[model samples]
Target: MDVSSIAVVGIVLLIFGYGLFKRTDVSDAFCEGAKDGVKTAFELLPTLCYLMLAISMLRASGALEALVRAVSPLTEKIGFPAEVLPLAILRPVSGSGALSLLEDILNRFGADSFVGRTASVLMASTETTFYTVAVYFGAVKAKKPRKALAASLAGDLSAFMLSALAVRLIFG
Candidate 1:
């Protein structure tokens, strides 16, 4: 097997050996952890589903396209490729939607081209901001998310602008 495969096997063996040395019930511990994980996932399921449905509805309503048109001129002037703006806009809201837009951008502009590279960088740099906020904040049962949402969006905007700049500086 390859080095990575061997390394994974080695790690698992090491963990098992350590558990034996410690006289711990590693299987029971693992089962308990898995049970807790399932519980957490179940707790977050409704919130994530609601957020995803809302995002899908917004996209289907053409609001995404209209927002892109409204923002395109300013982004273009700033040297950001307007072609990837839809990815930028959707990325903060929905990862699947952003990934779909990224595929379109890469297909429309060949993957090695400037716009594609910029989108690649942007996709790498930014987070699924709303989804993260929904999951983490919701997990903690935080009643108000205004501050977290604002901070995450600010981070996303910075990443979006810098992704284009980084590609231009690196590839040009």
Candidate 2:
């Protein structure tokens, strides 16, 4: 097998070996972990559903394209590609949405082009902010995440704003 497979097997063996050495019931521990995973999944389900619905509505209503067009002039002056603005706007809300946008950008612009490279860098550097906040805060049942949300958005903004410059510097 490959090194990765062997490494995974080694890690699994180490965990069980340690459990055996400590006189712990590994199977029971595994069952407990599985149960907790299921619990966490159920806890986060509602938040996920709400997020998906919001994302769908935003896309279906053509609001996303309007926003992109509205911001195009200003973003173009700042060295950001207009084509990538959609990905930037969607990145914070949804990973899958951002990914689809990225794929389109790459396919349309060609990966060797500036737009593709900037989109690639931006995608790698940024997080799915709302989705993250939803899952984490929803899991903990925290109602107020204003500060966290603000900070995360700021980080995404920085990434979006600088991605093109970074690609120019790196690839130019």
Candidate 3:
């Protein structure tokens, strides 16, 4: 470890040892905190389950595929490879689904193909915005995550655009 981290760890151990010497009831506070953490985890479980089921249903219902098809022509017009369009659309909803699509593309078209390469770049650089921010912040009971969610989506969009442009310029 770095010198600062080592020093910090040493200081923490010193303080902890001193706490034991002074016989402070720190254990009670830690136990209480752990109890609260368990309560919070239990409270969030149902919400997390619902979100997972909903996302899974969206994937299985072919609604995601419809979305992909609807947007395919526009993306194609903008010079994105048509084959990668489904992954681009679904990437924000469910990461596993997106990765499946990307893997299928790579397997069928070959990893070095333009479509596979572009999807890899896009997937690598982009975040699973809607699934991540919405589920995480909502589960955590954050009151004002609207701005954070917007920013995450914006970043994903920017990365998606950049990946598309890079692929088109470099390999189209």
Candidate 4:
């Protein structure tokens, strides 16, 4: 196994040993934690399902493609490929959707192509902003997340622009 795997194992063992030393009921503690996790998962399930359904509808209805086409002019002028615009837009909302789009880009433009490299960099740079905010804020029961959502979307835009620029500078 890799060093990181070994480190994780060591950490787990250390925590277990510490619990034993403290005379804590480790098994009961673990069970309680697992129950809490299950409760949280149930709480988040509806949100997750809604997100997946929305993504599917967006793709199936061709709304995503229309949005890409609508932004093509500006993207083309900014040196960003119109083809990867969908990936950039989806990256902030859904990781799996963006990943599928990335795979399509890699397949269509060859992994070694400039577009492919930019997409790869973009995938690394950005986060699933909406999904993360939904899950985390939902977990914490935060009702007002406007400021956090705005900040996360802004960061995602910056990462998208920088990824495109960096790929161009490095590869060209």
The lDDT for every candidate, in the order shown, is: 0.83, 0.84, 0.76, 0.83
Please provide, for model 1 over 105-128, each residue's C-alpha lDDT reduced to its tens digit, 9 standing for 90 to 100: 787689999999999999988889
Worst 10 residues of 3 by lDDT: 47-56
* 3 versus 4: better TM-score goes to: 4
Candidate 3 lDDT tens digits, 24-130: 77688668878999998787667656555765676579776687688778887777776677777778887766766676678877998887888999998887788
CA RMSD for every model? 6.8, 7.2, 10.0, 7.0
Model 3: lDDT of residue 62: 78
Candidate 2: regions farther than 4 A off: 1-70
- The lDDT-based order of candidates, best leading, equals 2, 4, 1, 3
**Residue 127 lDDT (model 4):** 87
Candidate 4, which segments miss by more than 4 Å at Cα?
1-70
Per-residue alpha-carbon lDDT of model 2 for 42-155, expressed as tens digits? Answer: 876676666657656776798866887888899889989887887887789777667666766788789889989999999999988998987788878568999999999989
Prediction 4 TM-score vs. true = 0.61
Q: Against the hidden reference, what TM-scores do the models get?
A: 0.61, 0.61, 0.55, 0.61
TM-score of 1: 0.61
In model 3, the runs with Cα more than 4 Å from the true position are 1-70, 135-141
Model 2 CA lDDT for position 96: 66
